[model samples]
Target chain A: MSGPDLLVLATVATLAGSGIYLLLERSLTRIVLGVVLIGNGANLFILLSGGVTGRPPIRGLFGSEGISDPLPQVMILTAIVITLALTAFLLSLSHRAMRLTGDDEVRDDEEDRRVIARVERELARHRVREEVERMRRIHAEEGFRAGLRARLGLRGTVRRERRELRRRMREEWERQMAADDPEGGMDTTMGEDSP
Target chain B: MNNVLVPLPVVLPLLAAGLRLALAQRLVRVQRGISVAVLAAVVVIAAVLVYQTDHYGPQTMHPGGWPAPIAVMLVVDRLAALILLISGVITLCVLIYAIGQGASDNDESTPLTIFHPSFLVLLAGVADAFMAGDLFNLYVAFEMLLTASYVLITLGGTPARVRAGMTYVVVGILSSVILLIGVALCYAATGTLTLAQLAVRLADLPPDVRLVLQLTLLVAFGIKAAVFPLSAWLPDSYPTTPAPITAVFAGLLTKVGVYAIIRVQTLLFPGEALTELLLVAAACTMLVGILGAVSQTDIKRTLSFTLVSHIGYMMFGIALASRAGIAGAIFYVAHHITVQTTLFLVAGLVERRGGSTSMDRLGGLARVSPLVAVLFFIPAMNLSGIPPLSGFLGKLWLLRAGVQEGTWPAYALVGVALLTSLLTLYTMCHLWNRAFWGDRGKLPERGQIIEGRRGLSGTGIVATAAPGTMVGTAAALIVFATAFTVAAGPMAGYIDRAATELLDRRAYLTAVLP
Candidate 1:
C-alpha cells in the first residue's frame, strides 16, 4: 500500500466508524450527520477503489496510464446527489419531528407501549374472569353437597325416631298380651327367644 | 416484438409522472385518468414482455446502441418480466384504490396532486430495478424508488408519519450507502459494473475475496429485504404510512431487495459458500419475524411483521441454491406481492369502516360490511397459507425443495416454516376475533376518527361506508391472488423456466453481451 492509499483507508475507517456510532444516537440531528458521514465514507471508498491518485479522465490529457477510473467518480457523483437529497429529506423530517415533539431527538413509539400495556391488561382480565368462574363453580358444588348432607341427616333422624316408637308400641302390646295369657305366653316367648 | 419494448415498462411511467406533474394545475380527475391509463399500459407491456421472454428467452436492449460491456443495458428475462407483470398489476390496483379513496373522502389531508406523480415515479423505479442489467443501475433504481417512497410515506405530513419517515429514510440511505460500497468494492476487484461481466469476472477471484464481496452485498441487500436482524426499521416505518403507500411498499419494495439478492446469488456468486449462513438467517427471519407479528396488536403492524417473516421463505429458497429452490422462491415472491398487498388494502377498508385499525377498537365488521369481511377473509387466509391458496402452493414448493436438499438445517427450516405458517394463522385469527367476531355493541359508536395525528374525538360524526371502487379494487387483488392459485401449474412452470435461466449464467450473458 502507498501513502495516499493508507490515508484513504484510514479516512474510510474513521468516517464509517463515527457514522455508525452517531447513528446509534437518539438525536435526529446526530442521525442525519451519521448518514452524511457514512455517505462521504462510501464516496471516499469508491474513490480509493478507483485507485490512489490519478488525473481526470480526459481523452488526450496526460496519457491514459494514471487516469483515475472515471466510473467510480461518476458513481460518487450520483451517490453525492442521492445523499444530498436524502439529507434534505432528513432535515425536513427533523424539522417536522421537532415541531411535533418539541425536540430533535427520536421519541419512542407511545402507541406501541400503550398497545402492549392494553394487551397485558386484557390478558390479565381474561385470567381473572376464568379464575372467578372456576371459584364460582367450586362454591356451587360445595353448597349443593352441604344441602344434600343436611337432607340426608334429617331423613336418618326421622327413621331412627320412627323405629324407636314402633319398638315401644310392640313392647306395650306384648305387655298387654302377656298380662292376658301369662303361662302360655311365657312358655311360647321363652321358646321363641331360644330359637 | 421489438427490443425497444424492453425499456418501455420503465420509461412510460416516468413520462406519465412527468406529464402528471405538468398537469398538476389541471383537474384531479384528469390526472387520475392519465395515471391509470399509463399504469394500465405498463401492465400490458409487462404482460407482453412475459410472453416474449417465455417464448423467445431473455430480451436485451442498449439505450444508446453502445456495446454491451460498455453501454448500460436493460434485460427483460423471465424473472424480470414476471415480477414486472405482477408489480404492474399491483401498482395499478393500488392506484385505483387510492383514487377511489381520494374521490370518496375528498379530504384535503391526503393531497392527490402529490400522490399521483409520486406513485407513478415509484412504479417507474420498480420497473427499472426489475429490468436493470447493471449493478449501478440497480442502485440508481433503488434510489429512485426510495426517494419517491419518502414523499409518499410522509404524504399527509403528520407527526407520526414524519417520525416513521425519518427512520425509513435513514435506514434506506444507510443501506444504499452500503450497497454503493459493495458496488465499489466489486468494481475495484473487477474492472466492470455490469452484472454479467462481474459474474464472469468474480468467479476467477480467490475464495476469500469472493466471500468478502458476497458478504458485503448480502448485508446491504439483507437490510433492504428486511432479513431478521436488519428488519426492525420495517415494522415501525411501514405501518405509519398511508394505506395504499404501505400496501405498495409491502408488496414491491422489499421484494426488490429479494430480487437483487437472487440476481447476485445466482449470477455473481454461484457457489454455496454462504448457504448455511443464509439458511440460518432464513430460519431466524421466519421464526423471529412471525413472533414479532404475534406480539403486535395493530393490524398494519401485524401484517408488516408477516411481510418480514415471508421474506424468510424466499431466503430459504435462495439458500437451497438448487433450481427448484430458486424457482420456488420466485413463485413465492409473486404470490406474496399479491396476497400481502391485498391484505393491506382490506385493512385500509377496515380502517375506513371501523374508524380504527387497532383491533381492540374494531368489532363486528362482519355484520356491518359483509363485503369487507369477505374481502379481508380471502387474503388473510391466503396469507396464512391455508390450503388451496397461492400461499399454500408457494410454501409447499419451498418445503419440497428443502426436503430434497435433505440437510439437517434445511429440514429444521422445514419445521420452522410450518411453525411460521401456523403462527401466521394465529396472528390472523387473533385479528379476526378482535376485529370481526367480537361484540358490536361493545364498540364505540362509529365516527370519523382521523388516525395518528388526532385523538379519539368522537364528535358524533358517522363513519362513511367504503366506496365501491375501493372495495372493488381490493377484491380485484384478491381475485388475482386466487387466480395465482388456480393457475399454479402454469405459473410454477414459468417460474421454473425463469429459475433455470437464472441458474444457467450463459443464457443471460449471451443475451446481454451478444
Candidate 2:
C-alpha cells in the first residue's frame, strides 16, 4: 500500500522480462510458465497504476477520508479470472504439443514450412515485378510525350495559335453585334483599321 | 421466467451433464434427447432475447432481484445477441449432425455417451459467457466452457485426439492461471468485479496504472483471439478435432475472445494508446496469419491458419475506435463466424469423401461430390472477399473506415488488407484444386468411408448419407452469410448503432453503476 510506484512498476517489469526469458527457452513447460509470470507482471503494473492512496477501496458507510480507486481492482478481478481459464487451456495445449511430437521446443513441420516459405518468396517477387512495371510505364509515358512535342512543335504553336484565334474571334463577335444593332457606326473605323 | 432463463444458459448443460454422467447411464437415447432439447430451448430463448434486445436496449436480469455490481446479472446486448444467434444455429446443426452420425462406431464407449452432455455443456458455457455482466461470472463461464471442451476434445481418447486434447488442456490451464493472477491483481487495484463499474473506475485510475491493466487484459484476450505472435497453438490443435466440434470452436471460441477485446477496448479503455497498439497488433495478425495459411497443404490446417489470419481484419476495425471501424468489426465478426465454420465443416466432408484432409490424398472430389464441392466453393469464395458476399462487404467496410481515418498506419494497413485478401484467395484455390477437382483421388477408399467395425454399414450409410447434414449446415450458414451481404446496408447500420452504443458507454455504465 505504501511502496513507490517506480519500485512496483520495476518489479513487474523485471518479472515480465524473466517471463520473456523463459518463453525464449524452447521447452513447452518453461514457455507456459514464462507466460504465466509475464501475465503476473502485467497485472502488477495495472495494480500499481491505481496509485497507493491511503487505503484499499472498501469504503463502507458514511464519510470516506481517502480510498484507493475501485475501478482497477474490479478490472483486475475480471482480468485475473479470464487469464486463469486461458492459462489452463494453454497449458493443456502445451503438454499435448510435447507428447504429439517428441520435442519440447516447437519445431515447424518441415513440409508445411517449406510450402509457406515458397509462397512468401513468390509473393515478394511478384510485388517487386509490379513496382518495376509501374516505373517502366511512367518512363515510357514521359518519353512518348516528349517525342510528340518535338515532332509537332505543339507547345509554342498551340500557344500562339490559340492567342491569335482568340483575338480574331473577339473582333468578329464585336462587328456582328454592331452590324445587328447599327447603334454605333464607329465600328466602321475599326473594320477599316483591321483590313 | 426471467430468473430461470437468466441462469439456464449456464445451468442446463451443467445439470444435464452431471445427471447423465451420474444416473442416466443406461438410457443413451434419453440422455441425448434431453441434451438436444435443452439446447434447442436455449436457442429459442436466445432468439427471443435477440428480438427483445433489438426493440428495447440490452436485457439485464439480476438473479434474486439484486442490483447489478452486487448480485450477478445477465445482460444481453446487440453484440451478445448476434453471438447467441450464431451459436444457436451452429449448435442445432452440429447436434443434428452428431445424431445422424450415430455417436461413434463404438456406442458402448463412455466417451460416446458423454458427447451429448459435453456438447450441451459447451453451449451452456458459450451462452453464459455472452450473457455475463460481471467479470467474475465471465471467468466462471470460461471455466464452464473449457471443462466441457476438455471432455469433448478428448472424448474418444484415441491416441491422436488425446494428444491434441492434452495440448489444449495444458494451454487452457496456463491461461486460466494467468487469468486468475490478473483477476486477483484487478481486485487489489479496483476492488469490484462488475464490468460497467470497472469502466468508470478504471478511467479515474492514474494513467500508468490504467495502461498496465489495459495491456494485461488485451494480452489475455489476444491469446484467445490468436493474434499473430501469440497464436502458435491454433493450427496444430484445431485441425485434429472431429468436424462438428471443430466447427463450433472455429465459429465461436476465438470470436468470443474478439468480442471480449472489443468490449474491453471500447468500453473499459477508450484511450488512444490502446487503440494504436491494437491497430498494430491487428496488422501483424492479418499479415502473419495469411502468410502461414498460404503454405499449408492440408485443408483443415490451411483453414485454421486462415482463421487466425482473418482475426486481424476484425481487430483492425476494433482498433480504429471510430464508429465505422467498430461497426465494420462487428459485422466482420458475424461474417467470419459463419464463413469460418462453414469452411471447416466443408473440410470435414471432404475428409469423409477423400479419406484424408491432405491435398495429396484428396483430388477430383468435385467430380464425385458436386454437392460437397459447391458447399466448399461458396464459403471459400466468400472468405476470400469476393463480391456480393459477406466477407467482401465486411472487408470493404473495414478498409473504407481505415482509409477514412487517414492515419499513415491505418492507410498502410488497408494495403495490407488488400494483400491478405488475395492470399486468402490463393490458399482457398489450393484447397479447391486438390479436394474437389480430380478423379479417383477424390473418392475415399471404402475403408476410409467408415473408420471402424461396429455396425459399419449403418455408420457408413450415415457418413455417405449424401453428406446431407454437412451440406445442409453449410447451406443454412451460407444463407445467413448472404443475408449479411445483401442486407449489408441495414446490417451495417445496426452495427454502426451498436458501435455508437459501445463508444458512448453511458447506457452500459449508468445502467450498472448508477
Candidate 3:
C-alpha cells in the first residue's frame, strides 16, 4: 500500500486527458463520452488507492496483515454504480436534446445570448455614431475652410472643397442610415444628411 | 443522547420514496399525504436532534448498527442539526406547494406524479449529506441528491429544460468525478475515509501533500458550490426548472457544497491552510456573481445569479476560519436558504400575474396583485441586506469578523463584501422600479405567457392571483426568514457555540471515534 502504481496512474492520466478534451466540446454526445472516460479514470484512481496488486483480501487465504485492503474496491463498485446511473441519465438527456433540436450541441442560455447580442449591437451602433460624428465635424471644418477660401478669392479651390465635402457627407449618410437601427437613431441622421 | 433520530432523516425519506413510487399508480392524495408526513416527521426528528446535540455535544448513529469507520456513519451535531432542521422545513413547504400547484392544474404539461418519488429521494440526499460522517458517504449523498435533482430539473423534458439539463447533468457528474478523485487521494494519503480519522492523520502529512489534498477537495466543492470561476452552469440550468424544484435546489444544493467546505476546513485541514486562497475566491465570487445578477433581464435568472453571489458571503466566513467567522457563515447560510427560496417562489407568482419575468415586459405588479408585490418585496429587500433583516445581520457579523481578523486580504474581502451588498441593492432597486413601480407595460397577451406549469402552464389561465397553497407556502417561508431578525440574538449565540465546537474539533472527533 506504500508506493504508487505507475501503470494505473498512466492510464488514468491518458483517460483523463482525452476525457477533458472531449468535455470541452459543445456536443452533448461527446460530453457524455467524456464523462464515461473520466469516470473510469476516477474508478482506476480508487482502485489504485488500494495499491497495485494484493494478496487477495480473502478472509482465510492469508493473515490479514499481508492482504490488500478491500475498501477502495468496494468504494469503486459504488462509484461505478453511480457512474452507471448518471451515464444512463446523460445518454437519455442527450437523446432528448438531439430529438428536440436535431443536434445535441449545447445552446447558449437564451437570455445570455440575448444580452450578448444586445451589447454587441449597442457597441456597433456606438462605433457607427462616433464615425458619423467625426465625419460631420470634418464637414463643418471643411465648410469653414471653404468659406475662408472663397472670401480670400480662391473660387476654384473653394468650389472643389465644397464638392468634395458634399460627396463625402453623402457617403457617410448612407452608412449612418444602415447603422441607425434603434428608435430615434435615424433622427440623428439629419445633421449629416444635408447637402 | 437519543441518536436514533440521526438515521431517520436519511432513512424515512428513502423508504417513503420507495413507497411513493409504489403508490405512484394509485391515489395521488395518499402519495402526497405520505410524502408530507414523512417530511414532517423529519422536521420533528431534526428538531429533536438539534436539542439533543446542543445539550449533549454531538450524537452518532451507525446504519445497520455497525460502529463508525465501518458501516455508514451518521453524526448530528449543532451544525448538522441546524441545517437539517431548515432543510426539512424548506423541503416540506416546497413539496406542499408542488402538490397544491399540481392538484389545481388540469394540464399535463408536467408529470405531477413524477415529483412524489424524486422529491422524497432528494430529501433523503440532503439530509444524508448534512449528517454524513465519512467522505465516501458524503459522495454517495451527493450522487443521491444529484441523481434526483437531474430528474427534478428535467421533469417535463421540454426543449428548454432538456437543453439546460444537459449542462446541469454534465457539470454535476464531472464534479462528482473530481470529488471521487479527491477522495481517492485522501484515501491514499491517509489510508482511511472517516472524517475524524482524516483529521488526525492529515495533520502529520507533509505540508506539500496536504496542500495538494486541500486544493483538490476545494476545486471539487467549489464547482458544486458555484464559486466565481465555476458558477456559469448555475444560472443557466436552474431557471429552466419548475419553480418549486428550483426553490429547493436553490435553497439547499449549493449550501450542501458550502457545508462540505466548512467540514473540510474545520475537521480535515484545520487552521489557516488556505485562507488567502479562499479569501480571493470569495471576493471574486461576490463581485463576479453580483455583476452577473445586475446584467440579467429575467427575474429568475437574476435570482439565480444572486444565489451564486450570496454564496461568497459563506465562503468569506469560512475563509476567515475564526469562531465568529464560522458562526456568521452558519447564520448567513440559514438566513439565505429561506430568503432565496422565497424570492424564487415569488418570482413564480410574478410570472403568473405579471405575465413575464423579463423586466422590460413586467410592470405595475404592485397594483396588479398587492399581495404578490408585498411577498416579493420582503425577501428581495432582505436579500439585498436592508436593516432589521436577517441578511443585514448576517453581513454585519461576517464583515465584523473579517475586520477583527485584520489581514490585508481580509480587509479587501470586507470591502468587496460591502460593494457586493450595495450592488445587490442597486440591482434590486432597479428591478423594483421596472417591474413594480413603473407604468404597467403590455401584459403578455393570453397566448404569450411562455411558462407551462405542465398543465395550465400556458393555457386556459386560472385567476391571475397565485393559488392559496403556493402563496401560503411562500408567505410562510418569508415570515420564517424575517423572524430570524427577531431571533437574531439567541440564534447567533447558538451558532457561535456551534462554531466553537467546530473549531475545537475534539468534541466531534471523540464523539465519532470514541
Candidate 4:
C-alpha cells in the first residue's frame, strides 16, 4: 500500500535507458552489457514493485505486519539466474564470433545480404529495361513527333532526356554488375550497414 | 490423473534432460533414446490432458500446496492442452528427424551430446509455458525455452549461425526484458502474479491503467510472436540453423508467443478494447510478411517469412474477439504448427537432395527425389491454404468470423488475410517452379548465383541422400496435417467448445481458485 521509493525508480530508469542505448549498438559485447544492465534494472524494478520495506521478509525474524513481500524477491532471484545463464552464453558466443571474424560486431546474415543484393540488382535491371522501353517509344514516335518538336524547339529537351536515359541505363548496368560481383564482396558494403 | 499429468509435461522432459546430460557423449545412442521416450511420454500426457480438460474443465496444479496468490500454479485448460499436444507431436517428430539426420550425416557441427539436452529442455519449457497459470512462471518458461533455443540455433557455431543467432538473441532478450517489466507492472497493480487472480483484479483498475498494462503485455508478446515490424529478425535468423532445430523453432517458438498473447488478451483483458490496434498489427504482419516471403530466393527463409505471415491470421482471429474468432485462432495455431513444421522438414530434404534451399541453385528435385517433391508439395499447398487443406479451413473460419464481426477494420483484416493467402500460394508456385520443376542444368542464372556465401554455395554441394527415418518422419507429419482436413468436423467442434470455455473467464477463475 505504501509508495515506491523515488530513488529506486530513478535508478531503474537510468539503468534501463543506458542499457537500451547500449543494446542498440552493433557490437555483441556492448549488447551483452546492455542486456545485463537492463536485466538488473528490471530486477530492481520488480523489487520496487513489492514495495520498499527495509525489513527482512522472514515472518518470524521480523514482525509479519512489517515483513516485505517475498514473491518479487524470489522472482528476481530466478530472473538473475536466467540473466546470468544468458550472459555466459552470449559472452561465449561473442567470443566465438570474435575468434572467427576478428571482431564481435554482429554481422549481417549472408542470406539476407544476398536477398538485398538480388533486390538491388533486380531494380537496376528494371530501370535499364524501362529506359530501353522509353528509347523504343521515342524511336517509334520519331516520325510523328520529330517535326512538332523541331517546330516547338523542344528537340534539345528530347535529346537531353534520351541522353539522360542512356546514362542511367549504363549506370544501372554497372550497379547491377557490382551487386552481381560473384565473391559478394558484400563485406565492403554491408558490414557497415548491418543492424 | 490431471495432477499426475499436468506437471509431467514440464517435469518429465526436464528430468530426462538432466539424465541425458549426465550420460553425456558416452551412451550417445541411449541419450537419443531417452529424449525420444521423454517427448513421446509428454505427447501422450498432453493428449490425455487435452481430453480431460475438455471433458471435465481446466485442471490446476500448485507446487508444494502453496497459496493461490503466490505459488507457481500449472493449469491445463482446453487451449493449453491442445497446443501442448500439437507441440509435443511436433517436437517428437522433429527429434526423430534430428536423430535420423545426425545418424546419417555424422555431422560434428551439431554435437549430439548438446543437441539432445538442449532440445529436451526446450520441450520442457514449452510445456511449462502452455500450462503456466502464473505470469512469473510464464516468464521463466520463456527464458527456459529461449535459452535452449539459443543453444540449438548456434549449434554448429558456424559464422552464419553466429551472426543469425546474434540478432535472434538480442531480439529475444529485448522481448524477455519487456515481458519481465510487464510482469512486474502487473504484480504491482494487482499485488499478485497468478493470472486467474489478475483476471479478477485487473478489471477493477482504471481503464487507462488497464490499457497501459494491456499494451505493454501485447508489445512484449508481439515481439515474441513476430508481429511486424517486430518480425524482421525471424527470417534472418531461422534459416541459418540446422534443419530439425529450425523446424521445431519455426513451428513452436513463435506460436508460443501467439499462445501467450491469446492467453493474456482473453484471460487478463477480456473486455479491453485493443481490437483496432491488433487489427492493424495483423494486417501489416500479413501483408509485409508475405511480401517478404515471396521475394526470398531461399526456401527456408521463404518458409520462415510465411510462418510470420500466417501468424497474422491467428492475430486476426484473436482481434475479432468473438467465439468464432477465438475458435478460428485456436484451430489455426494447431494447423499451422503441424504444417509449418512439415514444410521446414521438407525444406531440409530439399537442402540435402537438391544441394541447396536456394531456388536459384536448386532444380529438378521432383525428378531427383519424387518423395521429397510430394512431401514438399503437400505442405506447401496446405500452407497456401489450398481449398481442401486444413489451412484453408482455418482461414475460412477466420474470414467467417471477421464478416460476422461486421466492422470496417474487421473487413480490412479479412481482405488482407485473403491477399496473404494468395501471396502465400504465389510463393509456393515460385518454390515449385524454381526448386522442383526446373532442371538445374537449364537454369540461366545458375552460374551467377552467389557461390561464395558460405552456406548457399549450392553450385558445388556434395549432395547427401536423406535417410529413411528423416523422410519418413516428415511424411508422418504431412499425413497428420492431412488428417486435420479429414477430421475438420470434430476438430472444429472441439475448438468451438474450447473457445467458449476460454471466453467464459468465470470457468477458468472458479476452476483455478476453487
Q: What local distance difference test score does each model get? A: 0.83, 0.72, 0.83, 0.83
Encode model 2's per-residue lDDT on B1-514: one tens digit a residue: 1434556666777787787778556877787777778777778877776677667777777886876678778877777877787777777777776664554443445445667777878888888888888776776677778777887776544334544565566566556545555555565567666888777777778888777777777777777778888787787778756777888888888888889888878877875546677778888998888988887877888988999999999999988888889998988988898898888877767766665677866777787778888888999999999998988899999999999999999998899899999999998887787667756563545445433211211233223524455567667777877888777777777677778888888766665564
- Regions of model 4 farther than 4 Å from truth: A1-4, A109-112, A115-195, B107-110, B442-462
Candidate 4, residue B133: CA error in Å?
0.7
Q: What is the lDDT of residue B143 in candidate 3?
A: 95
Runs in model 1 deviating more than 4 A are A110-112, A115-195, B107-110, B441-462
| TM of each candidate vs. truth | 0.87, 0.75, 0.89, 0.88
lDDT of 1 by residue, A22-50 (tens): 99999999998999999999999998888
Candidate 3, residue A158: the lDDT equals: 45
The alpha-carbon lDDT assigned to residue A167 of candidate 1 equals 68
Off by over 4 Å in 3: A1-4, A62-65, A127-195, B107-110, B444-463
- lDDT tens per residue, model 3, B1-514: 2367689998999999898777656776677789999999999999898898889889998776676667668888899999999999999998888777776565433365667788899989999999988999999999999999999888766666776788889889988998999999999999999898899999999999999999888989999999888898998889877778888999999999999999899989887548888888899899989998998877998999999999999999999999989999999999999999999888877876765677977888887778989999999999999999999999999999999998899999999999999999999988888899877786654344333223223233343577899899999998899789888888888899999999999999889886
Scanning candidate 2 chain A in windows of ten residues, the lowest lDDT window is A179-188
CAPRI-wise, candidate 4 is acceptable
Candidates ranked, most accurate by DockQ first = 4, 3, 1, 2
Q: Could you give candidate 1's per-residue lDDT for residues B238-352 as a string of tens digits?
A: 9876678899999999999999999999999997438899999999999989998898778998999999999999999999989989999999999999999999988888877
> Candidate 2: deviation at residue B458, Å?
15
lDDT of 3 at B375: 93
